[model samples]
Target: MWVRVTILGRCLTDGQLALYRIPRTKITYSNIKYDWGGWIMVGLESECGNGKRKSGGCQARCAADGATARVTAWTHTGIVVCASLALVIGAPARAGTDDAAGNAKAARAPVKPVTGRKKPAQAAAPATPPAQPGAAAPATVSRAWSAGPGTAPAPSAGGAVSPEVAKMIKFAAFDKLSMKGWITTVPPAAESIFQDPNGLRTALAEYGIGYVAYSTNTFTANMLNNAPPKPQTYQGQIPTTYSFSEVTVSYDLGRLGLTGGQLSVGTMLTGTTWEPLGPSGAKFANLYYFQSLMEDTVQLQAGVFYNAQNYLGLLVAASMATGPQALVPYELGLSRQGVPAPGANFMINLPNNFYNKAGVQRSISPDGADVEQQANPIGLGLSSPDAKALFIDEFGYKTFSSPAQGSVWVRAGGLYNTSPYFDFSAGRKTDTNWGFYAAADVQVSQISSAPYEAYQGYYVGGFYMTSDPNKNMYQNYYEGRVYGMGIIPGRPMDQTALIFGYTTLSKSALDFQAALTGIRPFGDYASVTVSNSFRLNPGVYLMLGTSYNVHPSATPRLKNSLNFMASLTTAF
Candidate 1:
């Protein structure tokens, strides 16, 4: 028998099938008998048959024979009841074999047609496998992360920072600051040092020390003075003269958010010294007593400042003098010659434009020169010589700015001194004294574009200080103004100052008339200042400077002075 089968959605023909053996059943043919156990059937169809009968009753005869012979006929119709029952009850089913002579004929049998319907053209190809989870997606390179809302998500491991927090972080990094230091060099006589006229010459120093610390707040301290002057004439020299030395410490407390403005407190201690103008000048007297002059005097100062962002600022300060109170008498007595005499003076200063890119400053000090004498003059020597009280008032303005290639500064000020005891003695004891002083300084290459080592510059500055006639006692010859200018030039180790100066003293008489009345004496003075620095290495330096003053009125017309200094600084 030929058979067809379907497996895994595909049909298989008999040629592609494999044959197997099993137990066989009895069979009978029409009017023909065969052995009961090994009968074979031929020509089977797999489709269901139509209900139709042949005229000769072939189907019925075939069925009767199939029953009598106990043979099974494989067909599209139902099988015999007993045979189907036997097959279902576990009778082994088997394939039929064709006769060797009929095999070729059986292989040529036609296949039955499928009746009801046909199978689908083909089962759809197996679906593609689903994608796996956590797989990376395609990526694109970019210069910066996308900032659009809901576009690029923040890192999953951490939370996002708020805009305010991010802004604060940026500000902190940009606004942070630290402390720094600076060094300044000031020339001689640039600073005031109050000293006694009859004391030892201890106020002179070659170099001064400065300490500065700055951050948001700034602090500065300065100590400077000039070399004491030598004597010029015999009777014209005093046993002791007051030298001026000031130590000022200023603090900028503006950074504390106090907004109350900047505040500064400072104290100055000025010593007394006596040294004449030249070789022919007289020696100092009462040196021991003069040494205690500054010890008995104290100065107290307090100031408040207001600064605006537009490079403008204002300062108001009040200063008071207290101590032995006798130093005033000695200072007044020395006013007989030269500039206005130095003394224990009380002043109120108003400074403006303290710190700005333009560097402009203006100040006014209404000073009381004889406050101590008006109170007590016991320790000052001469006893109560109908002396008039003295007062000194000063007003000045200074401006410093960079212009193109260099820097320039101008300072103009006036001084007025008055004494109450104008005509105490022979009208010669006139009291009120006043004068004007002004100075201008310019730096040639301070704003140069070259490297600091190759930088070159020069400065020219001058000052004029004078006082009107004042007859308060003692001698009052040098009571007028003095004028001078100094020229500074060079860079690094090469620097010098060529100074031309002069002073005029009021008339004086040795015998009240001296065969000469209303006599005026004019004096000419000249000085040369040479300063040089040798840089031993990057961390070491040696500095030397000297000054020579020539007074033509004395026997020895040449006055020589010198100052030397050396220091080493290192950085890490």
Candidate 2:
């Protein structure tokens, strides 16, 4: 594992020579300083091979007045190791390219570099970044491994990373990370396997590799309720709101330049701790690809179809948009229930305020839910289909006003799904026969005058689904939402919202319930959802939310269901 050497030339590091690659020479070094990036010469010669001084060879030293000059003898016999050289070697690079591809054999047990967490909503974006990839320059070394530890830091038998290589390793391992890595010694506080996903993602992205990871735990418990087939929970029927972790990794082949077309393939996973690589909760784990054409203006996406966070935004503008539209849903699409879904879907979008999507999905029996049926060489869970369906949606965006003229953005879209998740007694095969929804949102008041990103917005929409008329889930429904983002002056991370909506069940559904159970089930009922999200730090957040059914039943019309929840979200 020795690195051969031959002085290639002066590294034009603005006069710094951290690394110089020259072929066909064995490893031998006398003095090497990563500080201010010193110079090193390479030749098939050594004066202090076994600590025995030979008479005629060159001496390396830190020029007394910095890069301006040098004061050393070309015929010194002993290796001249600079005191500063020890400082830089003992410290690792904070950011640079990944380890060279040729050094695979000497690789140590892999370092965990989790990145790109798709946090629940807007939180899904990568965590707070350290610095852009291009900005990862030679950072100033503030401290060194000069004392404390009994053993001084040393590279593996493969030799210490050149100041250049060190930068690359440091960049990939711990660039822009909140939890710094200790090259000289292991930091005492380093206990968790999860490091900074944002930093790792940044480093990878620099090399056209994509990375994302995040974990979430949310609870939804009824304060008062009396219903059969209760929720599954350790707390006696309390339903877990959402508890899962997910990751996405991708690489752009177009950036390589040799390829004429731009293409990127990404793999995403959502799973529990027991099965970290397995797909759970709506079965969103799958592979997808992205293509850039027409000079990056138009983009295409296809593969396992999972509705991205913002199918529509009643409050937040990004991924965590509230409502049933967000969250990669299992019971999503037209024929399915109100949730996101997974299947092979295709979508197209661009910066011109135009976007379109279409996809087909088939439902599976609850028995086939947890297990994945593999396909050919590299596909998962492609063998189950309980309900066959297709969905299509197109939308356009327009700004009614500008930031300086008072912010107002309106978004409208129409969606239709031919989903058959259920069958009814009179009209069709299922209670949820077909569904069509048209929606519009207004970014009413976003105080651009404020010191932070502040906003007040609302939306109104209607949805209609058909059944056997005797057993309809939602005949025709209207819903509305009012939310504010970062509106509390300096508390820019805080978001508050109140969502109220009504779903009018068909008369047949009510009558059918009465005849079958001797009790009239809920009819045209209303519900309210409220939430407050507090961002502890840009990377961590806490959410407090609650939902209640105002009219619990049709005939009795009693105030019956009240649910409350709390959650801690981490993006890494």
Candidate 1 segments whose C-alpha is farther than 4 A from its true place:
1-263, 267-403, 421-428, 445-447, 450-456, 470-495, 508-546, 552-572
The clash tally of candidate 2 reads: 23
TM agreement with the true structure for every prediction: 0.33, 0.52
Which candidate has the highest TM-score of all? 2
Q: After best superposition, candidate 2 residue 371: deviation in angstroms?
A: 10
Tens-digit lDDT string for candidate 1 (339-422): 121133222223452211211111111122243233222222222233333332333333321112233334343333344334
Candidate 1: worst-modelled 10 consecutive residues by lDDT: 312-321
Error of 1 at 92 (Å): 99
Could you give candidate 2's per-residue lDDT for residues 1-572 as a string of tens digits? 12112232333233443222222111212221111122322211222333332222222332332233221211110111121111112223221111234221221221322122111100011001010000000010101111111112223322334344343333322221211111111111111134434455445645655444444555555577543333221111234344545454555554565321322222333333222112234333345555545433444544443333323332221111122221112223321211123454444554544555555544332122232232211233443444344444545443222222232333344443343444334534442333444545455555543211212222222223222343244465455566555555665445566665565666766766677779876676565767666666534556676666555445443445666756655555
Worst 10 residues of 2 by lDDT: 129-138
lDDT of all predictions, in order shown? 0.22, 0.34
